[model samples]
Target: MASVHPRVPESGIMSRPRPRHLAPVALLIVSALTLVGCGSDDESSEPPVASATEAEQETPGPDDEPTEPEDDTSLADFLRSAKVDDALVNRLGEVGDANGYGLGEGVETSLEERQQLATVQVGTCRDVAVGHRTWEGIQASDVSSGGTEEQAAAMADFLREEFCPHVAPYKEAPLPKQSLGGPEEDAKGGRGLASPVSWWDTRYRRVSWSEECAAQTGQPIGDPVAYRLSDDAVVCATVPPAEQLKKHLISVDVVFAEPVGEERAQDAALSLLPIDAVAEDETEGTNPDWSYLEGGCLNLNIQSQDLEDVVAGLKENAEPWAHAVHYSDGATADGAVGPYTGEVKQVSLSTGRNEPTDSGDLTC
Candidate 1:
């Protein structure tokens, strides 16, 4: 046999050994190609496992919907979050252990009505904050009552910040001063400023004749006849049909002025009455001068149509005096001696003077 070389495969001569580093890389490429070729076309197939970092970094797909956030900004929610007292919360229309605050149509008040209540509450708080009115005065107001001083302050801040931002201006703007009496004072006296004098009228409501007429009587009576009962009281009567010429007493109010003490006010009111006027009734053990009028003041229920003529005559006689006379309808009759434009010192239905009684005496 001719020299036989080790049988070498014909392919072995053309192929060279891959480097060790490249061998692993070549194996990976081949494995990937094998996976791609063997993979199913269906999208339902399991996806490839992601690395820890890649998994977290994955974005939401088309069908991945986001959830809506819960609403935590409502008034009720705000009250709860603020940790307000249950009693105070009840006043704000929030459901609480206490009764409703009598705002709007009870607890189920409309949005508009609630807003109105908030406005009023905020305004009152502003008054208290500005020192124009006290927290004690809140109870005296017909609109805003029943809230405590602390509650009033808190609710004012809450409403201004969360509820009624439009009323924020009231925080800076000071309101006109009101003659508000404290609860203790109101309890001692009837209303308004507490006074010792019997003739001092404190129960007077600041209402116009028309407003009083509409309030007292169901219907709105036009151009009702008014009479000056005394400096403090004006009796507004409804003018019925011609057949019923007798006017009905609808409302009684005081000709308001700066409050003086009870004794001086009583004396002033007593001095304003017509000299010829007779006592409607008498209370025993009272001063004889005060006995002329009932309740230490003129009768508010006086139903005399002739009182207009009497008032006119008294006004004519008073023209020569130095002071100005304040009438019920807010008209002032100037006297000859002085055009006295000061606040009416006093007014009472029980008192009047046809002639000047005493120039130094203050007019009720």
Candidate 2:
């Protein structure tokens, strides 16, 4: 997302992320025998787009496993066609794939060691909240959810259970937070787009945001099939419904040490997604899920966000992901508050040479 310039003009299609279930539609021409089976199936003529991370986490699906990958295209290919990196792609793909069985899901790459391990998991729900990254290391075996001070302290309880106490949990720092300033404040605790937005359109849809660190799962930074966490920390958000949003969640099980040496721990990821394996009508459309199903090695990264973003509902830049937005559709005007966060650390009003100060680097 940082690659695209702020002032760059957008075409008609790059506009919005709304009407999630929109697709090409046409009445089916079924055979005589096929007509009978139609009574049992309720088919939708619309095309399926990516689901949000919040919705997926609430509904359990295939995204919670590390060994299984949906039989669909890699998340990278999909986002690359849209505009993003492979690592981000893998992160988003898992979100789109989550259907049932997996809770939080997505791919992450990291090194493992004997006594310590660093792991990350990500996921996406239709509308629960934006995506996120998590960090887990030598603290895994005895790790705490960090839900609350008391919840974190509970790890010691398991350690003292005289019956069986081989492993336990411990408290760690809470995940970073983003300052709130958007529509999401009413429900979740993620950040929002900066004021005064700018807009655009892509692929015949209105896609707008000020800043986005989007992840598109299915492609690997080095591996694939990430995350297989259980469904404890997940909660459902409304924008997307229960069933449609359930198809995107990939959880990573990175039980390996971050400072991995000769004896590295094995990491795994598992997920259930909108496989769309059988395209009943070839003329109708191309089922997007076919590509990711053909799998590869899965990575479990211990990142700074949620357990599922395999489909990128909300991805951010740097480790401490901040809330940001992009504009689309005629929704934003030029010189808007959005796209405010730029990598441009330079001043432009200078003549022959630019002066530099503590403010930032200046360019003529």
Candidate 3:
């Protein structure tokens, strides 16, 4: 400039030349000082912009993980989060759904009307998790017909992980076999019928009664014979002896408040005895009164091949008989036959009068 640089315009200014390396250093220093000055001047100023790596480390990305679910989340909320069908969820919240879930009576009354819906939905899930109810059963039910297998499984898993952790082990556990009055304990001695009369005497006074005798013992007989023991009792017997004898072998004594007719006596006998032993024709043309017998006794023929099995069945069914006659009817009879004594033989029943003395005033 001092040596007379060519006529430069006034708008254009000329500056002294500097090293390129120093230029970059000076620029960085100026930026740092500007940031410092800004921070010092205003305590509330914005912070410095973060670098690419710093921003990534400090800020969450779209793929950031979610936190754990809260314990108090409602069943509908959970099911929706699990992607369960909305139709199924709404149906589950309907009234009387608790009973459908196997939550027996009083649920509606015990819980608030608002709470019942959630309770039922949660109960269904818990039952499925604990092996009390099946996922298939739930699917077949009206409430969950629209839900798929995956949705059902998810509900069970939700119950295990959230509501009831104790049910988790049962989720894989084998369901217990249904009981069908399984085989009873073996009869101790040779099987023969014994009366509950002896046991009844200890509890109530023994009533005495006379009986009319009848027999058809030689050949295989076609029909059972009825002997009236009292106004409320009748003894029906299979005429043919189980073995060679002059008396009936299988006898069923029925006692009730009403007078027992021949038809009633035959029906009662068939009910107590095994079906295989009775002829097909024997059941024909008979309108069996299926009403419960008040008090009764059975004399099992000692010669029977399945005496032990028959006795076991009788013992297993004793509770219902006791309930019907003794407890409900307020009778003094034990209502069930006594334990087998192994002493009653063909000769013991020779008189053909097999009345049971268990019922106090209603002996038969």
Q: Which ten residues in a row have the lowest lDDT in candidate 1?
A: 3-12
The local lDDT score (0 to 100) that residue 295 gets in candidate 2 is: 14
The lDDT of each candidate is 0.28, 0.18, 0.28
Q: Model 1: residues >4 Å from true position, as ranges? A: 1-99, 102-108, 115-119, 122-132, 136-263, 267-364
Task: State the lDDT of candidate 1 residue by residue for 1-364, as single tens digits.
Answer: 1100100110011011111112222333222222222222223235588998888777667788887887423333322333433344334544211223333222364443342333234434443444433333333222233344444455444544544333332211122223433232222221111121122222222234433222222111122333333454443322221111212211222333343443443334333332222233211111122111111111111122233333232223211111112221221111111122323332323212222124322222
Ranking by lDDT: 1, 3, 2
For model 3, how big is the CA root-mean-square deviation? 40.8
Candidate 3 lDDT by residue in tens digits, 1-364? 0111110111011111111112222333222222223111114344588899998897877898877775432433424333444443433323233332213222332222223233334434544544434444444332233333554454444444544432111111121223232222112211112222122122222222222112111100122333333355444333221112222122233444443343444344333333332312210011112212222222321122333343333222221111001111111111212221221111112111122224312221
Clashing pairs in 3: 356-364
Write the number of the candidate with greater lDDT, choosing between 1 and 2: 1
Worst 10 residues of 3 by lDDT: 1-10
Q: Order the numbered candidates by TM-score, best leading.
A: 1, 3, 2
**Whose TM-score is higher: candidate 1's or candidate 3's?**
1
Best by TM-score: 1
After superposing candidate 2, which stretches have Cα over 4 Å from the reference? 1-71, 77-238, 241-364
- Residue-level lDDT of model 2, residues 151-256, one tens digit each, is 2233223212320121111111222223322342112221111101111000011111101111211111111111112221111101111122221111111222
